[model samples]
Target: MRAGPLVVVGDTLLDVDLQGTSQRLAPDAPVPVVDLAAERPRPGGAGLAAVQAARLRTSRETVLVTPLADTDDPDALKLLELLEAQGVRVVRLPLSGRTVRKTRLIAHGRPLVRVDRGDGRLHGRTGLPDAAAAAVRGAGAVLVSDYGRGTAAHPVLRALLEELPGEVPLVWDPHPRGAEPVPRARLVTPNREEARTLAATARTARSGGYAQAATDAAALRARWRATGVSVTMGEHGALLCTGDQPPVLVPAPPVPGRPDTCGAGDCLSAAATGALAEGALLTEALEQGVHHASVFVAGGPAPRGSDTAEAEPWDLVRRTRLQGGTVVATGGCFDLLHPGHVSLLHQAARLGDLLVVCLNSDASVRALKGPGRPVMGQADRARVLSALGCVDAVMVFDEETPTALLERLRPDLWVKGGDYGPLELPEASLVRGHGGQVLLLPYLEGRSTTRLVQRAHSEGGEER
Candidate 1:
């Protein structure tokens, strides 16, 4: 099944980041002194969750419900821009209080301290307006991301859940101290420590051995009326228990190299939500979620020291330059990364010293093609492209046209399929402007991504 429309509600936050290199130790202490390089902010809390959902549900409609203060925080604007770029419809609930901002202090690539700013109060206690309620009602599934910032309190959540039909799925990631007994939720995900806490509270009237753990978890699920319960155990992996199914244990995959564990849980929750929304069974969704989480935890770039880390854009121009070799640059969605794409890449590599393939990010793909496009994700596509021996580098751009990238790379020769005429190609001018030649390689007749997607759909293949 293809992913369907999703609604996300909960606290929204701003993630303020400071990045730099440490050149010397602090005079007062042994801590390294960091020379700031760049500063940026990303959406956090429910906002971050919404971003992940947008990626997974690239082909489906997405709506976000959160309270935001009308303020001058660039971080807030950045977050909004990101959501808009992803084609997500954000329904902002006005709040007089400031948006939550978590600022991290880093030196030499390692985090030293984090400072949080904002009032920890929930806004719009009157309940979701009729319009917001209608939006949630129209969604196929709903996810609540609670960060204990008061946006997802009992009143708002209850109102939203009450509006959802029973068949429409509801998943909850509860805040540590939020109101409990989430009656309408189909599933509840809590980490091992949180599970233990819930268990201890449930058994306050009874005493038992280690069996108390299982008993408590089951009791909590029953009390909440949730069909499924998931307990994330970090490196130990996760355990999923459903009412009628046997408990399933999913072990964590080995990381290729040590990686920072940040955002793994968010990735897991997002993947699970996406799979469930797509109609996958609980077990199947859990497996895919674990797989996605493993990839994130294993493949993220390493941190520097005490300095905040940022991902550097892949330098396709450098990689496509081989000694005494010609360079070929091509850009596209490359959605399926099929054998045809492999053949074209190989053919392009043969004509040049190196092959640099630029891919459209999920957002760009959606803008170019209507909804229900890009059979694969940007990260997945990039990974596949990088793994190919014929491909030298892969870069992701969130633009309808790759003219800017073409200008930056200034390849010796820019190549595209003959399907497009030179007059219609936007990158042609950029390549020519950089003193680079443009070539139109003959496209494989009768072999195109559109045809492949149509055939796959006809054969009952899942859209995503």
Candidate 2:
């Protein structure tokens, strides 16, 4: 089964990156004149969180509840189109002013200057729409991406957020100017500077260094009445404080150089919220968030429109299809990741431009191969598969068969490694019905997970 829909509530903005080459200073002024090459526009703030959520949880629905200017406004229209293209469903609230847009001038992947303009605000008189309220109430997990643009401060929306059941995970990414998160929030995340400011305003002790951040986190959690508080310290990582337990520090993986961290915070919150929606423990969620954010930053900014490290599988499929490139897909448990699997995947990759692996979820693997099976969990398995140069994307499915996922992907070619043919294979008919070709290649001789496991057990008992 798919995870419940992810609801991101807060303000939305239009973010644009103007990329160009800057070689020398202008003759007229001391400033360097940039030769513009490309313009990349993407959803910002809550819209960005929604896009990130959708990317991380490909099987789950991601919804954004925020205000937007009328479609007549070019920036707003662009934001809507980008969010839609990213597979994020937006529930637009009425806006009282123009859409907020931020433009950054970049040279060689580094931002030179950022320009921000807009007066967009949620219509103060307009109450939360019924549909948006329902979406918030039904969400499996909620992320309040407060950009301090009034949506998080709205009384009606805040009221509804306050009433959400405790069972639903609530992650609040706070802004200095935004309204305080509801007392029911499960987690409150604030950057180092924001945390320091909030702590000082509350008449709490203020000190320097990472040790002080831990103190700030605990103070903020108590003051906000939240279940946990995490203070994010850029490259140093995040310190998480929950309950009476000792704070845990989740450090960032080392990157070679200074990474452009413009949207790294949103990336972190979105990843953590996605993990929570998938029923991961708080600590596990934070670990995943830190790792994803590091990866996102290390990959550098998407100089163009496409995100480099965290590109959505759906987006890849659409782009490939648009270019008339053949898409190939294969499904399997992929436990242990033996040489047989690698050989088959490499052969399949040769048949198409992009090869997507439909992996069986942990639950599905357990049900099919028994409890002791799947030596690696689904996430680990998927990570290993994605690291393979031959594999383009990894899609996990909970069902016994990947029929539903196949229906969604509708690849041009379906490949499997076995002795089965069109008739013996359960998914062959479905593949053919969709006008897709199915090919079965012989497995590498004497290489299988079952045989490997049996040998391991036999060898263990033989001696040592």
Candidate 3:
């Protein structure tokens, strides 16, 4: 599904985290000293919401508006860099107060002490309201992430909502401490405790029983005049309440084992906003949100991790060597099947004992060419490639560049057509990076698929 443009407004903070291991007790004090391994900073608050929005709206544009201090906070800069890398547009409003920073010390995968600095307020900021309203006006939907740091409050949120088109959806993640004068929002996402607080009821009565939780969710939705309400119940999944529709229970996908449950809520809110922007019903959006949260809880490619622990290219190399096969690799769009393609496949097969053709998926082809191109579908192309006796395996990639896939495959030899320049091949650097050699095969000059298609079109002939 295609993603749509989303505008995210909320509190912006910096997360400074320290990671280390605890060794023998310190002699000076009766406390365990953690040997610092590394310290890192990431985007938190509204910046974090923007980052999450970028991930969900892969196709659509994302704009984030938040306040930052001119004091040159390294953590704030890192967050900006990350948002820029994800192609998210950011508008920074300068503030006189220091940028909020939350520093957490983690020992053996557990959080120790969390120190917070800076008051979470706009603090006599100029032009921020106008800039934020402009951002909201340009979006299909707006998401407000209220970390209770004071970025998302009455006046700012009311201004933002008024600026948006009436049909445009508004989603809010409310904070308990500052729930007064709730902004008019289409959807409100709150955890069980937050929902109880918003409803001004006992936390245990609201969350202790399933029936009570459902009652609380409905009451809160009605009180806030929201069209939809989603209460995220960690481990148990989420409960959704919508106007005129039966309440839907979205069960969390099974997490294989114990997991570090950080960033799950952020992921959920991002996915839900994306799904809603795509015109999905509330239930469908809730399901998609749960799915996204499950992936993060399962330790997927999250911002918190240093590097993804994927199988190294050498591992695949060793496995292929053990099978006593010479691995052959080739790549192309393979849009239309023709005699030249058949001939090239045979030639590539002869160069090695086994041939693996990497076929670009439909999305990849569309990215390379325009949307009107890719005359054939990915499945058909894969079927044709696999049917050829010269081809052993067919793999598909959805990236415009196959550098990541090539780095993973690490074939013994990489082959390409003579038509492409040595440097033009997408996998050229990757092949050479791991000491693999690249070879160019001779092309049948006249037997081109483009020429064949042109001839057929001119002659009023169809080849299928």
| Shift in Å, residue 463, candidate 2 | 8.4
Cα misplacement distance, residue 115 of candidate 2 (Å): 1.1
Local error of candidate 1 at 115, Å?
Answer: 1.1
Q: Top model by lDDT, which number?
A: 2
Best-to-worst ranking by TM-score: 2, 3, 1
CA lDDT of 175 in candidate 1?
61
| Full-model lDDT for every candidate | 0.69, 0.83, 0.71
RMSD of each: 11.0, 9.6, 11.0
Best candidate (score: TM-score): 2
Better model by lDDT, 1 or 2? 2
Which window of 10 residues has the lowest lDDT sum in candidate 2? 300-309
Error of 2 at 383 (Å): 5.7
- Give me candidate 3's TM-score against the actual structure: 0.63
Q: How does residue 276 of candidate 1 score in lDDT?
A: 82
Per-residue lDDT over 208-232 for candidate 2, one digit per residue giving the tens place of the 0 to 100 score: 5677888788888989999889888
TM-score of 2: 0.68
